[model samples]
Target chain A: MSAEAERDAPAGVDGAAPADPWRRGRWPVVTILSVLLVATVAVSFAVGVTAYPPGTIVEVLLAHLTGRPSTVARVDDVTIWLVRMPRIVAAVLVGGALAAAGAAYQALFRNPMVSPDLLGASGGAGVGAALGILLSWGSAGVQLSAFALGLAAVLVTYTVGTLVGRGTESTLTLVLTGIVVSSLCSALISLTKYVADPDDKLPQITFWLLGGLETVTVRGLLPLLVPVLVGLVPLMVLRWRLNVLAFGDEEAASLGVNPRVVKAFVIVGATLMTAASVSAAGMVGWVGLVVPHAARMLVGPDARRAVPVSALLGAIFLLVVDDLVRTVLTTEVPLGILTALVGAPFFLFLLARGRRAWT
Target chain B: MGSIRVRIALATAGAVTAVLVAGCGQAPGSAPEAPESSSAATRVVTDVTGAQVTVPATITRIADAWPAHNEVVQMLGAGDAITATVLIEKTAPWLYVVDPALREAQTVFTNSTANTERLAQARPDVLFTDKSTQIAAKTTELGIPTVQLGFQNYPDLKKMVSTTADVLGPAAQQQAVAYNAYLDDTLGQVRGRTASLPADRRPSVLHVYSLNPLVVDGTGSIIDEWITAAGGRNAAQVTGNVRPVSAEQVAQWNPDVVILASSAFVAADTGAQTLDKLRADPFWSQLPAVRDNRAVINPTGGWHWDRYGIESALQLRWAGKTLHPELFGDVDMLAETRSFYDRFLHHPLTEAEARTMLAAQDPQ
Candidate 1:
């Protein structure tokens, strides 16, 4: 772990002892992750329930993108461009959002174990989605309800924590309130499930709760793209500041940064990304928690490098998982199950190999 | 906890002794002078959960706790005997046509959950329900006997009808026989015509039961039974009674016909979403069934055709006609609906009413 970090630490070491490996940052790692992510997404197109010839799929893709008429059948063209495109795009968007949020959260909270829903967003969104399904709101309506409710839940927790805290101790209060709100959201979800109609509503809630990217449509993606981009752009803009804030409030203050405001901005950005992703594709577990930590191992703890790397890794990882889910199983296996099955082992591997990275 | 356990044991012993004493003097159909005397000629019978319950021998009144179970009981000519039931008007409009007086029957359930206080107040001789620990605990703690039953397919329906007849006694016995006979006759008639046909010749049928999650009735579902009987191949080979399936699966199967059994709720309210929405989805629209407009809505009577109930025969006949029109050419589905209601429930239906009951329409 130390060998790579030391080797990757370029010029300006500024000490007789050495440089802090955590600041051994960016460029090279980002370039590699970018190449890998694009390759993984392109490969995902060939895998599905219906088999398509890879040669034909590539030709159709080139023709469609370049605005040239394809000899490919209309059905195959529609399947590749219309059907697979929305799902593939959704996978990238949801995966990237969750991982970025998770990275921002791990940085802001100074805890690697913390997930994207360091606040109550995912749990709260679950309650919203369940209620929407119970109300027969249809697919798009449920997504909107989930997005609205998730943001509302976090705002409530943030408000309560700020209103009731002793100055800088609000961070402590916010974490505690997030825990309380998450528990409350879970209870409300259970209540909603219990009250739901047995035949139609109950199964929808149960299946939806397990999570999938099966229903991602182009129309649904338009509204979702706004909130997700709105969330992500700020995180990208504030990446260097996020790195500064990671060194503790006193250190951040010494470096001419307001710890409270930076923390707030990061939290809002991360929470928005999380709520948007969860609303789009039910509660997909592990991507947010694990991806950032893996990215940190490669690029050091600089948010500038780690956050984008996490987004790329998360997008590629989820595309692979979703591909395996739809193709490998006879019935569409729930996305949550595959992530944990695959993530837990990889996380254990990361823990062993990157133990020094954390310390 | 100790006191509660002792009280339960004591109550059970007392009830057992009381039932033994009264049951010795009673026969199956002889009514007690008072229905709620606690020892009103109790007869011991084992419920589906394997719990022995001491119900009154002449059960003039019963609380049909699970409304789906009402189909079996109603078909057993015990519709008038159900003193308490779940919501009837919406879930089972057929029950109203069969027995108008049941409109005033005590609503025993709050949605699917039993209102135990209201149920106790109503004082039915036995409670007809599916086996659950809560209900079993309640029945044991209180001295009310409960019978558990479920209907999954036509064969299971016949068994439930027979069991309901046994529970309801001799007067309802004929209806159980009629139900068994009707089920056999319907399937038999469909099979006799369909049996000789080669597998390749049969239409491949897709039975979509839910829309939001896009679930299909796979193998072991009642819809599968109807499809095979109706001389059609079941498109979905997935296991389990009902399973959430992908659009790709339906597209891959590419059934000759698509039959949707949605909530009359979705059909009536989401007019925009009626199979048309499915037909609009890029993946779903590509399905051969959707593309050719070979989709038809399942005619819901009593409960949905996919939902376990008494209307299997009607659903089967409907599927048969849809799948094999030439073979079932003489079969008038609307006329069959009228005849089934008239013969079984003894309720004459107008042609408009029959059409309304079936809710079957070819895709626009």
Candidate 2:
């Protein structure tokens, strides 16, 4: 396919001609998104409750990078390094991981509407976090429990799917089982909230379910880095196979890829990434489902291009949204609410336009 | 295929059994009809919600649903009348330590919703709940006289105490007067000392309700009321109770004094550990309060003293002394706490027990 023709090709048509996987326009889209992400991060650094001028922000960054003591006010230095920097990094990591996992799942399932939480990772994480808050285990315990339960939820879904649909449609069984498990997890979360002390733990769980990056710190982000990177590297490396798996099971098997094995790998990678993101930032929605569609609209249906583009777009989108959350009002607005507010309308607009990203 | 079918059946059976076992804890049944009220004398008392509730002349068996108001009932010398309570032993250890009978009281409510069957089973003549019209109406339908009470300021607290006393009887009414006098005396004393202090001299106090989410009690909250009464300005510019703000926002506020609630970090420990953790954080360490060691945990008694509990009298004195030690140098919190417990709670606290309470620790 010619580069000019690929630019005009409907998104559904890009999936038909999979031979010309690498379009010439992919680099420019990636480059623009990369530039936008970098600019968003820089701008987020300067935006916070504590106003730091551009010069002061740069000085703090330089001092930290060079392993030298900062001469600016200690409060400003701490605010920039300890509070804002960690929050900015968390927003990027969570947003990128969620969007990348989302793209992988969408390609694996051959459904444009698939989100990272479609398999019940977020619901399970929410239950874990609620239990931690009810037990007064503090922030570390909440994050740990959320990560563990998220993985457990997906595992249960997979096990049930395999056991019940031995010779039937595998993906359909998995999706049905996922819906069952997600609702179960949600009910468990509600039960935890109901039993929590209304004066204390109830508000904590309520706020956590709404999702925010307010509590994220440098030390808190350290433990999550390993899982996020572990999950992202494999998805990026196996993007071409994910694209091939987008075809039906028979076609994918004929194309020299074991459909079931590839799908399993994609599920594991997507689950890890989604769980880590949910554990770090509580129950942030819409980015996973919406960002991948935007990415496909920009770079067509090839996972090799769409996954990376989705990561960049997700990071930029969440970074900007988190900046607004902290700076818009004196009190921090929940991150999940803002993402849905922004994502839902944009999604409706996309649907209204009839982009043919999916049949 | 046959073996898989068996496994699925077994799993389905297991799930159903688990759910059935959970449901067995609370039997599915409507509450038994409450007995008709005795032809005894009745008096009308208006609650905080402006509803005039006709309470029985003598309320012996009481179901106190509001956890904080349980302390108020105890303070009014009606501790024995409480037949059912929502005060968990873990949440309010001091209350249970003082009145062991509270441990035996049936818990008819979890969080805010009352189980009507359980409430009727408790057989309380009067049900004390917060300002939830739904709960009040539900209990009223069962023929239980539900008194809705809540407070957001010192005046409202005094009104709640008076209304609670109205339901208890004449003897408790005297205790209410005494308690209200003590509150006014303490408030007047604190205000008399700190009233003349200039704005610059008054410290900007940040009441840290929780550290992980960094929630602070802002203006329009009872904590804000006490902060002002104790001669400190609320550092949080927002207006609400337990509003979560960013750490950077707190750093910007740069409060002169950071008061940690007893349950700030965890449910169990005194907030000293939470204070230590805050001082260790790079963000908090840079704050003026942490650097100067001005951060202190608010002492919790029957309830958090800084909250809307009856201990606001003690909180006023404590805050005044903490904020302006020079002005209130002669005050001894241990002696005041001992006297308060003896006079109000009817529990003669030893010196060590008083110290533990002042330190915001559970009684051993």
Candidate 3:
């Protein structure tokens, strides 16, 4: 860690301050995040099928990987391998990706209000998902189109923001464009709902909007995991650049960081992560906005420390919420509803504590 | 600083006071005096959205907004109380079977909310509805009490009969008991009729409609229970209630009896042509049920997802008998329909009207 710090930190640039308690370091954060990632994955697989136990989950997973069939009950096998296992994996990856993206957005725009959802990805994804239902697209096709449409929405937001005057898009301008784009997408979704068959199509669209992992198969999870990893890995590598960002753009530029290039990279990477997650999970809200704030309260506002913590916290938060849905109720509550119900009140409490933190 | 503390104290006190005031309504008051024993009149209670109401020991005037509820009201010997009802033509074409005189007495309500005021002017003692709907809520909030009843399942139907009877007084209790007995007997008959058939011989059924890609009944649903009782298998037992199954999966399952219920599709063309298209499809035609010509078309009238009363039970019997004529015996279902109308509907039907009603069902 010291060797890497000496390589990266300029000589005489280290100024230890009374206000900043500890110097931000990269290796420590990476070590913590790696530990958290493993723990979350383990927890995800551990949560389902109490009868079989966690050891049995490891064994079942190994057996499946090795092509050795077991005499397990088909329901147990299906629930563990087909249903619960994929969903658990999906939740962990998606949650981590969304959290990382949210942190990146906050740093890039130099505003905590900026998150992946600020670009209308979720809304556009919703419209695409509705269209899939309307056209009677198969499950695989539906998921694919949803992801594509989400990326398309962000692309439009980026293009519109950059095109107006300057090459760099201001935070306010990006937000306003997102709102407009989101409204247009929402209107299209409503139009689809208006003409949809009331019995079958309406329920499908409603359930999709509510956002649960019930329908996610291994096939759906695999393609989504690829983009999430691609987006997430780069964000983690460059996560140190985000800490300098909290010093404001002018200060960061003075510190020998190229603010424009860094901001663009982080924004695009974060948007990609959010789009991929939204497409697969179907508009799970509150995770991006609330998770980082939660991490800040837990570990304080150093991005080097906060980002990894937020990602871990986000993964744990979703995993527990998903478990509650599976066990707490006879009917599965939508993940979107569960997140909002829990997160919204907590957000209000945070706002009460320090309203300035919201901006 | 003292003022700030005082203000905070006041706010806390105000919240506490508000909570205490709200909590004060928890205690119950004393019961009202019981009515006279010698009156021989039935006491009817109503819950409607609006229109002033008066509870009486006997129902002198009734306003039936929902036609399915009107059938039960008629069956409970409260036909005289019914001053008006909505959807008479669509609900009980068989109403003429019981009392031909009810057809011409009065046209009390239309399908619009404007009719609420008109019905209020006519002055009804009770309003009847089948289950609570948005319209029922509006009418009840407007001070009109409705006796909501529907038979979507046996429990809901039993509750409807019992609740309606409780408010309809002594005469209704007798009718309720009789109706309950009739339902038991019919269910028993169905069980007995299907007992001898082999499990494999039981027909696999599918309910198709335009509203969804694929819709099927839940295993525990009344539709599944009735289908099983009739020696027919519901294809949806594998999935849960009205779930969206892929079209390819439906083709693979290939149910023996395809029952289409969407009014939207029914209005498209002759029901026969629609059935023919399904039959002609290579995947659909490959099913064993389709080759045997076992597709049965359900008639229009009292076709609802939630209403499972005596009328709905009869409809199930009609489907069973039509699908399995050899097992149920060669009975005229129209005659059965006529008797159901006569017993439960306030209006009498002519033979011509009965034919017209049945003909409207669209195998044509």
Best of the candidates, lDDT: 2
Better of 1 and 2 by TM-score: 2
Which lDDT tens digits does candidate 2 get at residues A262-321?
777778888898898888888999999998987776666778778877886787778888
lDDT of each: 0.70, 0.77, 0.61
Worst 10 residues of 2 chain A by lDDT: A1-10
Q: What is the TM-score of chain A in candidate 3?
A: 0.86
A295-321 per-residue lDDT for model 1 (tens digits)? 777666777767776776787778778
lDDT of 1 by residue, B1-364 (tens): 3223323432342343233223323221122122335455666766655657777778877787666676666666777877888655866666666677578787755332344434544567788875433333443333357776665567777877777787777777787797789889988999999999997999898887776677777776677788898899889878645577887777788899988775522556442357677678787688778888888777766556556777777888788888888899999988888888888776777888777666643211
RMSD of 3: 22.1
Q: What DockQ do the predictions score, one after another?
A: 0.01, 0.02, 0.01
Predicted model with the maximum TM-score:
2
Comparing 1 with 2 on DockQ, the higher-scoring candidate is: 2
- Candidate 3 lDDT tens digits, B231-303: 7888764533455567676767777787765332434555566567767867667767666776645554433
Give the per-residue lDDT digits (tens) of candidate 3, residues A1-359: 22233223211221221234333422333344444545555655555424457766665564455445455443344445555565676677677678768877776666776667878888778888889877867566667778888878888987897775376676667778888889989999988886665433565677677776655545455566668757765576667787787677788899998766776677677767787788777778888888887655444566665666666667666766776665553235678899899879977776665443333
In what order do the candidates fall by lDDT, top score first?
2, 1, 3
In order, the TM-score of chain B in each prediction is 0.82, 0.89, 0.66
Residue B200 miss distance in model 2 (angstroms): 58
TM-score of each: 0.51, 0.52, 0.50
